[model samples]
Target: MSAFPLALPDDAELSARLSARIGQHWHRLLAALRPLYGEGAWEGELAARLLGAAIARPADLRALDQVREAAPDWFQKPEMVGYCTYIDRFGGTLAGTRARLDELSQLGVRYFHPLPLLKPREGDSDGGFAVADFRQVDPKLGSIDDLRALASDLRARGISLCLDIVCNHTADTHDWALAAKAGDAKYRDFYHVVEAADQVAAYEAHLGQVFPQTAPGNFTFVPEMQGHVWTTFYPFQWDLNYANPVVFIEMMDVLLYLANQGAEVFRLDSAPFLWKRAGSDCRGLPETHQVVRAWRAALAIVAPAVALKAEAIVGLAEVLPFLGEPEQPECHLAYNNTAMTALWAALATGDTRPLSTCLTQALAKPAGAGWLTYVRCHDDIIWGALKGVIPDETLARISDFYAGAVPGSFADGQAFQAEPGAVRSTNGMAASLAGVRDGADNAAALARLRLLYGVTFALDGIPAIYMGDERALTNDPDYAVEPDHDDGRWLHRPRMDWTRNGGPTHAAIARFAQLRQGRACLHAGNPARPLLTADPALLAFERADRGGDRLICLGWFKGDAMTTDLSGLLGSGDWIDLLDGTDVNAQSVAMAPWGLRWLVKKNG
Candidate 1:
C-alpha cells in the first residue's frame, strides 16, 4: 500500500497549495507509514479525501490561513504568560469569564487554559474528561455563543484561548457508545468491543493501569452490552479504535469545528495512548505518531494559526517525538514535564542537581516549538514515572518532607494514591509547599516563596502561573467535605483569596514576578547552556541572543545567605543589578537565602 495523502474532493485550490508545500517531504512521510498502514493504493486515495475534507468550510479556513500569513510567530513572543483555570472556578460562567479580562491582563497573562467545559455525563465525569459531546459547552458553564464571545474578548486583549481536545477516548455516554450498544454495526466499529473476556485479557497482559487506586484494570466489563470495553483512565471513558477510517474523519471534523470557534491553541489530552496493539505497551505507539502527523497535515491546510500542544508527562525521550519537524511535525508545543517534575524535586530536597541533570539531557525542540512552563495546575504531582532520576528512596523522604511527616518539614500537603508499595502523588497549594501555611518564621517563608517564584520565572519558554498562586492562596479546607471536590487535587485548586493581596507571602510572589517582568531579556532569550557553579544550592545561567544582549539570572535554592564567585559566567565585568540598581563586581558576590539577582554588564 502507498501512504495516503491529505486530499479532499472539490478543493482544487487547497489541494494545489498543500501539494506545493508538502511535495518534497511527502514520500518520506509515506515511507514511515507504509509499515504500519500497509503498502496499498488505497492509502494515497484516503489521504486525498482527508485533505480535501479539511478545506470544506472555506470562510473559517481562509481566516486561519490569514493568521498564519500575518503572525507566524504569535507563540514565540517574549510576553507570553499563561493562566490555567476552570471557567466556573475562575468567574461563574463563560460570560462572567469574559467580564474578567482586565484581571488576566493585570497579571501579564496572554495565554488562557480553561479546562474542559464541554457537556459530559452527569455522574463521575472524570473531571470532564469523559466527554459526552465534543461541540457543545456544558449548560452549567454557558451556551456556544458565550464561548465565542469569550474567545473574541480574549483575542482583543492579545490573549490566546487554549481548550482541551480529549483525543484518546470519549465518555461511555457518547453518541457512538450509545449507538454501539444499540447494536448498530457502524458505531460498533468505532470502539474496541470484545465479545469474550479472553480477548481483553490478552491486551491486559501488556497494558498499564492509569488509575490503579480508583479503576485498577485496563478493561471494564459493561453488562448493558455484554462485552468488555477498553478504558485506560476511567470506566466511563471508552477508548476509540483507530483501525476504522470513519473514526478518523469524525474526530478530524470535531477538531475543525472547534478551530472555527476561535480556539487558537488545543491541549491534546492523553494523546500518547490513542493507538493500541496486542502484546505491546499500546502507549506512544508508532501509529499514534502517524495519527498525530495526519492531523497536523490536515490542520495545516485548514487552520494554520491553531497549534496542537501535547500533554505527555512521560519520560523525556518519549515526549520529544510529539514535537514534529518541518514536514511531519506533530505538536507545536508540549508541556515541559521533565522540568516541572525537576522543580518539585528541587523544592523538597533543597538541591538543584537533579533539575540541572535532567534539563541537560532533555531533547531540544525545532525552531517554532516551545515549552509551557508551569509550577502547579489543577492536577496531582506524580513522581512514579521519574523513578530513576528521582530515586524511590529520595521520593519517600521528600514525601514525608513535604507532608510535614518529618520534623521541620515546611510543607503541609495531602497524600494521594497512597497504596502500599505504590509511589504516591502530592497535593497542596503553592503557598503550603513554599512553607507559608505551617507558620514558619515570617522572613523564612517569604524568602522561600520568592525563591520558588524566581525559578519558575527564569525557566525556559512561557511561564504559566496557576490562578490564586500569585496571591499565595493556602490549601482549601472545605474541598474534602464538598461532594463535588472529594479528590485531593481540589486542595490545590482553591478559590481566589482576594483579601490576601498585600500579605507578606503574596507581596513576595508579586515582587518576584515583577522582577521577572523587568528581565524579559532573559525569559525571551535563546536557549543556551546553563553556567554551573560549585554550590549544589545555587542555580545560575546566562541567556544571550545573537545580537549580544545578555542577562544573568542567579537564584539560591536553599534559603541561605551565602556568597559565591560568578566570574566564570559573568565574563569579567562590572554589572548593574536590575533589582536594586547597585553596581557590583562579577568576580565575587554575596546573595541572601532564596535571594535572586538580575544582572546586566555595564558597557563603557
Candidate 2:
C-alpha cells in the first residue's frame, strides 16, 4: 500500500536532493525501523513518505537545515537559553506572541516552547495535550497561518520555536479516533481496543495509574467500539497503537507537516509510553527507544534543522535511553527531571547529597545531546523521579514540606494527586515554592528564588525560565475556581501580568544570563562535576571546558549564614566571584543565607 499519494518530484533538482538524502540516511532509517516492520511493503511506503516530505519542505527551511548541519553544536552552546510558556498565557494570540519575542530575546532566550497549542478536545483537554488534530493550530490561540508568521518572526529574532508533539495518545474526538468509534476496522487498528476482559486485566496488572484520584484506570470502556480502549493518563485520551505500521507512518507525516510549518523543535510529550508489551510495565520499553530512534532518523533525513526533545520524566536509569548512545543518537535534548526533582528535595531537606548523586549521573549523556534544565515547569514536581536516590519516607517529608504541611514551612504550594500516607507531587509557581509571598519574609523568598535560578543557569545544559517566574509570581490563589481547570498544575500556569515590571528576582536572572553567555566553560558539552562539600546545606559543582576555562558554582540553601573553605576544591588559585565583582580567598569563603556564587579563576 502506498503511504503517501504523491509520486516522485518532476523537478530534477528536487529529485536529486531527495535521492541523495535517502542514500545518506537509508541505512540508519532502516536499521531503526526494520525491528518493528521487518522486510516488506512497509519499507517502500515509508520511503515514499520520506521523499514526499523532503520534496514538500520549504526552500528557506532547507537553507536553515544546511546552516544547522554546518553547526551541529548550535543548541549546545553556552548562550543557548530557553523560555517556556503557553500561547494563551504569554500572548493572547499567535500574532500577540510575535510582539513578545523582543522580551524573550532580552532574557537571553534562544529557544521558546509555547506549551501545546494544537487543536484539542472541546473540554478538559489535558492542558491542550489531548490533541485532536496534528496539523491545525487551535482556533482560540490562532490560525495555522498565524503560527507560520509567528515562527518567521521568532526566527528573525534568533529564536527557535518549539511545539509539543503528543506522541503517546490522541483525544478521543480525533479524526482517527472518531473513525474507530464509527466501526472502521482499519482506523480502529490505530488504537489499542481490547474486547476481552482477561486482556484488559492482564495489561492493568502491570500498569500504574497516572491520576488515581480522577481517572483511576488504564482502560476506558467505549461502548461505540464495543471494547475498552487504552488510556494511560485520562479516559478521553486514547493511546495510539504503535504496533501497527500505519500509526508510525501517520505520525511521521504529522512531524514532517509541522516541520514544514516552521516548528524548529518538537517536545515529544509522553515519550516513554509510546510502546506497550503485555505482562510488563509499559513504560520506557526497548521498543519505545527504537521508535524514537526511527523518528530521529526520519527528521534527520527530511528536516535536519528540527530537533527532537524527549519529555520522558521517569527515573534516571529509564530516562537515559531516550537520549540514545552516540552511535545511534535519539533525542537532541531531554529534560533533566531527576536533577530538577533533586533540587527541590535538597531545598526541603537542606541536604545536597541526593542532588549531588543525581548530578553525578546526569553528567554523562550522548555526545550531541543536551539536558533541558529549569527551576520550575508547567507541571507538577513529581517526586517519583527521585525514588532510587532518596528514600520514600524522606520524599514524603519533602512533599509535605512543600505543601506547607510541615511546621514553619517556608513554601506555600499545593499537593497534586496525593494519596494519604504516600509521597505526593507538588504544584506551584517557582516563586511560591521558593517561599515568595506578601509578608516580611518576602526578601528572603526573593533571594531563595534567585539562588535556584542561579544554580539552574550555571548547570551544564540549556537553562529554561518558566513564564512569570522572573517577576517572582506567586501561586494563583483562584486557579481552582475556573471551569475545567481544577488541576493543581494550573496554580503555576497563571496568566501573565504585563503591566507589572519585574523586581530584583528579574534582575538577578538577567545578570545570570549575561554572565553565562560570556563563559565558555558553561557550555552544555562540558559536563558539570559535582563537588563534594563537608557542609550538607551547601551545594557545589564545577564546569571546566577543555580550553582551561573553569567555573565553580556554590549555593547555600540554609536560611542562616554559613562559611566554607574552597581551598580543597579551588586548589589555592586566585578566584573572583562572577555574580558580584569581589575577590575571593579560596581558604575562607563566607556565604549569606540563600547565597549563590559563580567563581571563575583570575586571569593571568
CA-only RMSD, every prediction: 3.4, 2.1
Could you tell me which 10 consecutive residues in candidate 2 have the lowest summed lDDT? 1-10
> How many backbone overlaps does candidate 2 show?
0
Runs of candidate 2 exceeding 4 Å displacement: 1-17, 418-422, 439-441
Tens digit of per-residue lDDT, candidate 2, span 123-234:
8999999999999999999899999999888888888999999999999999999999998999999999999989999998888878889888899999999999999999
Alpha carbon deviation, residue 64, candidate 2 (Å): 0.8
**In candidate 1, how many Å is residue 229 off?**
0.5
Model 1 has an lDDT value of: 0.74
lDDT of 1 by residue, 84-172 (tens): 88787778899988887777777777789998888988777877888999999999999888988888889888788899999889999
Residue 314 in model 1: shift from native, Å? 1.5
Residue 472 shift from truth in candidate 1, angstroms: 1.1
TM-score of each model, paired residue for residue: 0.90, 0.97
Question: Which candidate's TM-score is highest?
Answer: 2
Indicate the worst ten consecutive residues by lDDT in candidate 1.
Answer: 1-10
